[model samples]
Target: MADIFSPSRLGGTSQAVALASACLSILLVLYLMFFADLYRRPDATESQVAQTLEGRPPLDIHIEMMSLDPIRQTVEARLNFPERRADAAQAGGARVRLSDGGFVRELHLPADRAAGATSVEFGLDGSISAYPFDVYRTDALIAAFAGEGAQEAPLAVQLTVWERLPAWEARVVSRPARPGEVGLPISIEARRPPAHVVFALIVYAVMAVIAVCGLAIGVLAACGVRKIEAAFASSLAGMLFAAPMLRNAMPGAPPLGVAADAYVFLWVQVALMIGLVLFICAWARRGSPP
Candidate 1:
């Protein structure tokens, strides 16, 4: 047994060490992934505001976030106008207009059960300059209308303020109807999840490595510090195309020319292209080898 563990069989020991290291790395990665997922997971998938609306209601709006569209930059909201009370319209009105983000939406009081729920969309107004890190704000104002103009009413707002977006998380705030607004003004601020932000940073890091490699190759080849190979140009070309794919791989990547594109993806592409050109020039400059 001692002989089996002797220096003469160090290869086995090295292999065992390598295997253990690999296993340890995998375990660490899994642990991190799970921790990240748990940390980024929405505290509650659905924020049921059951108790929010108690009384003081002739009309109440159940505003549910249906989904978010990063591409179109819109938020889908489902308003359940349950047939409950129109007499609560305070000013003796059977109609209410929801003014949100400068758009006016009206739902008939004591909504017709046959008509079901009313759907409204609000534009996500924010800068997508820093994608994955971009934050958006959307709000709504409610008022009861006797005929045309909206009137203030004591509105009980029940907010179901949590929704798990594909990459973003919505944090909704229910602000009670102030002076002019009727029901309540719901303000939603959505941003990418922590895990997603971390993932995007990792992607940027990988892209940085690629860019550095390109710069190194280009500088080295231009300086004639290393023997240049024709294959290097092809490798650069491949990376030039593949780098965009890596950018697109982001959980919910925005269009080209985003902040990341300006900082990482675009630069990485430039690096590879420059490297390819340098390598090609060097390859051509060098005469036939012996």
Candidate 2:
């Protein structure tokens, strides 16, 4: 049995099996990479739009969320009405009213594609204390004017939040329409994609390794097991500065005091500082040869 488990005896077979397994894993990952998207399919977004527009109203304000600024708590969106462009022009162009509590705003969605899409910004109220795991929720009402009143329009009630979000994913849910509700009530929840969360974890792991290695070097020096050099000490000091740059490299990193800062950034910095101090103390005492 020991002979069967010997490294040299099993090397040929094990190398072939391991290589085949690695190749298969790489191919599978590549396949997924080709098709994976952080946003919903365009077909899916339009399908939902078609369903929501059915029998609702004559005018529709097709709202597509374009990008999100998590740090600023704002979402950028585009509004268009191609299907009702002709209708809107016949009825003095499509105009919509949006109400969020006491504040109300009017939006003019052009019917002509050449006229370009109307860009609007919505404020996000969700707290980002959780960072890469944060979710933002907001909603607005849609209503159109009719007859001679020149009423407001959020027409078409089609809200899509599945595009141009390379780092975030959002879900649009229908809010309970109040009896006196003047427009379409929509609620959106946006969260970081799995890639972001995975990246955050990887950052945490990398920070941990950096801190630990620094501590290991310091500890060895302080314990008199390893010689401390001036160049090595300077490198450790340089790392103290490099740590912040690494922390800021996170995708769409927020300002300081976020959970990620508390999780690994702070601790890593502290560890590195302590390690640098240890090395300095060791150098002072032993005075390793130049």
Candidate 3:
């Protein structure tokens, strides 16, 4: 019974194996380091554009922003406009309207309307309802106010929130607040990363074996060593099954459940890979045909 895990029993090829393993390990690590750039986050302003609107003049306004919640699928906003009176000498008053081009949009108007400033909300449903990673929703509110003479029509504000529905869900909340405090609630979420560390051990073991064996076989072949042909064939077959495992291994790796916990997991991976390579090399050496 050959104990494949015994390191000392591996044939008298430790020197050659060590040299080959070190070179192979460095090369594979370097390849991964180069490819890591593709997975990095882009550098740019955190605030992203959402919507654009154009309207008439005379509407001087200020906006106050609030918090946004994507899990609940809702956005709360407030709009403040110049005051206006409908009945006065120069027949005037401010008129406000809300509009959206059916971009999965929903609006929640203030339950209570008043003369000075008003609050409104918009909700989106479906896919667009959810917040996107690296992008924030932008709602365009257009306020058009015009009046002539003594009693200028009161400048009233209309809270119009427009968004695409189905692709997302939108909710609007309104509350009374002092003047100079009104804004649109914007929600931003990050896209999830792919590797999951929890199931990574299996992958590490598999890759170590493949990479180490490949190195062993390659070295033997380059030196015109005939006996290594069988080991080379096995190494090639093992590597094919290991590639996909590495791709999925990191994304699903469990997140650091607590602070500093990731360090423990990382060290474990390092140790496991080292142990696996040494064990595989020893076993392969011992198994070499007489």
Highest lDDT: give the candidate number: 2
- TM-scores of all predicted structures: 0.74, 0.72, 0.27
TM-score of 3: 0.27
Q: Candidate 2 at 110: error in angstroms?
A: 8.5
Q: Write candidate 2's Cα lDDT for 184-244 as tens digits.
A: 6776667887677767767777888888988887899999897667787888887788888
Span of ten consecutive residues with least summed lDDT in model 3: 126-135
Q: List clashing residue pairs in candidate 1.
A: 58-88, 142-182
Runs of candidate 1 with Cα error greater than 4 angstroms are 1-37, 40-42, 48-55, 58-60, 70-72, 83-93, 110-115, 144-162, 176-179, 287-290
- What is the C-alpha lDDT profile of model 3 across 1-290, one tens digit per residue? 46654665565457679989999999788668655843673432212222222332233333333444344434445555434322211223444444222233322222123344455544433232211221234333343333434533333343333322222223222333335422222332222222222234435545555555555555544444534334545545545445444534443233343222232334434444443454455546654566
Error of 2 at 143 (Å): 1.7
- Rank by lDDT (best first): 2, 1, 3
How accurate locally, in lDDT, is each candidate? 0.70, 0.71, 0.39
| Decreasing TM-score order of the candidates | 1, 2, 3
Candidate 3, superposed: residue stretches over 4 Å from native: 1-58, 69-72, 82-93, 101-117, 128-141, 147-290
